[model samples]
Target: MKLISQPGPKTDFSMLLLFTIVVLTMPIWLAPIGAGYPDLVQKFAIYGLFATGFNILFGLTGYLSFGHAAFLGVGSYTAVWSFKLLGMNPVPAVLLAIVTSAIFALLIGYISLRRTGIYFSILTLAFAQMCYQLAYSVLTPITNGETGLRVLQSDPRILDGVITSQTEDGGPLITNFFGIDMTKTWETNIFGIDVQLNAGFYFCAFFLILGSYIAMRIFRSPFGMMLRGVKTNQNRMNYTGVNTRPYTLAAFVISGAYAGLAGALLCVTDPLAGAERMFWTASGEVVLMVILGGAGTLMGPMLGAGIIKYFENILSAFNKSTLEGMLGFLPENMLDGTISVLSLFVGEGWHLTLGLLFMVVVIFLPGGLVEGAKSILLKLTGGGSKKSASAQAAE
Candidate 1:
């Protein structure tokens, strides 16, 4: 009976600005505290983009797609193709990838949109599985089969005037961008800590910032409101003479483009596109990210992506030495067999921790980490006065 007004441009932009400061400065702040934990920086950057785009679709339109990794794989393969057939300018590669993903989303959306709810999810899942299998078999020449598509010493450098990849020295291959070699690292002091920065991290960070900004803008747009309406009540939206197909299709395409951008960033950072990325599980993980961070919240999915990626990269990186160090406070004699027992749960089996976290989030914080944060803030800040009583569903 009552509609809550969305934030004005001023409030929306203020929120966006706050998020921008946190994202851009987080690496700098956490760099020293985390002991050079930049390895996951690009992963967060790419997956954050993926989850943000996903929010546009699942978060806004309430379409729970289980096969979104198809778009990511398509974008990555497209980028790798650009590197192989076109050039390494990055612009063309990225554009081609986005377009490829858009086309795929259009096709999938046209077909899948015909169904609703579980049917839609299943349709998308089937398409994604088909893509995974095709990449593994039907497109061996392009996809390179199970081994995955990768840069090779003999692969043609179409963008380069020369025929091969070169090195710093003229005698060897050159893997570079413009005149700048990408294989080098830049060491800088930040907060009295040595930071070994690299071009790839910066490149991915640019896209992450750009993607987050765009998502924030979309969240504030009138069209975004319509999508949220569609999400809240599609049947009513249709009864109100609104064409839900076009809106849902648009959401799908935009989300697809986001996934594509993330994929291009992935290839740019690693210079490879693997079939494993297309796995159905990969698609499911993005869904987990959105849920983990609280769907329909601007910063939630990014936070969710950061949490999972941190666990995957950082927690998974821990091994015997880490366990021993952690248990060192105890007597050395008591520390024996502790790491081996711990190894069963972590180290290589770190996904167990992720699963437990997801379960906890679902059970205790049904709205996910963002809801948990709000509740904690409500308790800690002695209740936030600026906070809205109504939950803001990010479009």
Candidate 2:
């Protein structure tokens, strides 16, 4: 397996530029597009973090954990409880979420790692389901059942440094900045559009960039190579005097922490911790993101997360009226049926689109979009050097 190396100056420089552009200007692009803009991007960032962390276990360590939602739920609950009891100081809540998630992972991993493959997966899934039941019934007072948790004015905002509320006029009563109120709308001109830029979005974007950077580094490290080795051959690794158990456990814990961080970030945006996020489907969806993007690739999971979340939020928003507007250019006889056909794969039934994508990807392109991109790059570069071909053949 390969280890992390310096991304060449050009690649590193390009990544820096890309980060600056996206993190700085996403608000501008998302604002005019509709309210879905900020929230959609936020979902991508958070889920990307979640998927990247999951990849550390499933992609690198070859451990399929189906109960990861337990950590996400744990994180979400921890953060929400922090807001409820401690205060709305986001930093503590985020940190507590990470720590709480880690503890859960450590405990769960210790037991689940005893078995490998399907048994391990089933164990994790059972444990997660156990947590779900506990939250639903046993932990009613803490989890607050189906209603979840929400912010209230009566709640203390200690460490909030500065807090603001929506005004009667429908504008922010106090502008969001570094604990400072601008008392003015937060925006600047962008391409003749009044972009509603705000500090909160930028703050979350910063975590997105940080999370991406961290994942990139992990993908390139010696520990990463060892994890990959475990994925490839746990038995072989053990015989070679390299213990795979701790490595696998570490990967699981780290992934759980990432999910926790994402859960906390989600709360920061909406300030609500919904129990529904703990559902197993949410865990499976993140796994889909990793598989779609190309497991074991740095950018693949993030790209996958973005694509799936985009479809969920943006594509699913399409309705009959919107379809009719576009189809107005077509002949009336052709319009209705065509729109109906398209609707089966999108809008309210968008999961059908996702399922199909997953099927096609698994059957035809097992390595996923990143692998597909690599194949194209290889073809463009003329089938690699003779020495490289020989080396690959040897492998």
| Separate clash counts for every candidate | 8, 1
Model 2 scores what on Cα lDDT?
0.77
lDDT of each: 0.81, 0.77
Candidate 1 residue 172 Cα shift, in angstroms, is 7.8
| C-alpha RMSD values across all candidates | 4.0, 4.0
Q: Can you give the TM-score per candidate against the true fold?
A: 0.88, 0.87
Which of the numbered candidates is closest to the native, going by highest TM-score?
A: 1
Minimum summed lDDT over a 10-residue window in model 2 is located at 166-175
Instruction: Provide the lowest-lDDT 10-residue window in model 1.
Output: 386-395
lDDT by residue (tens digit), candidate 2, 1-395: 22224577589658867866876676676666553345566676778788888888888887888988888888888887777665555677788999999999999999999999899999999999888888877888888888887755555545444343323343322323345332223656778876765455566667778777776677778888889899888789999889888998899999999989888877765567767788888878888999999988777888898789888887798888877876789998999899989878778888888889889988887888888777668668876564366657679
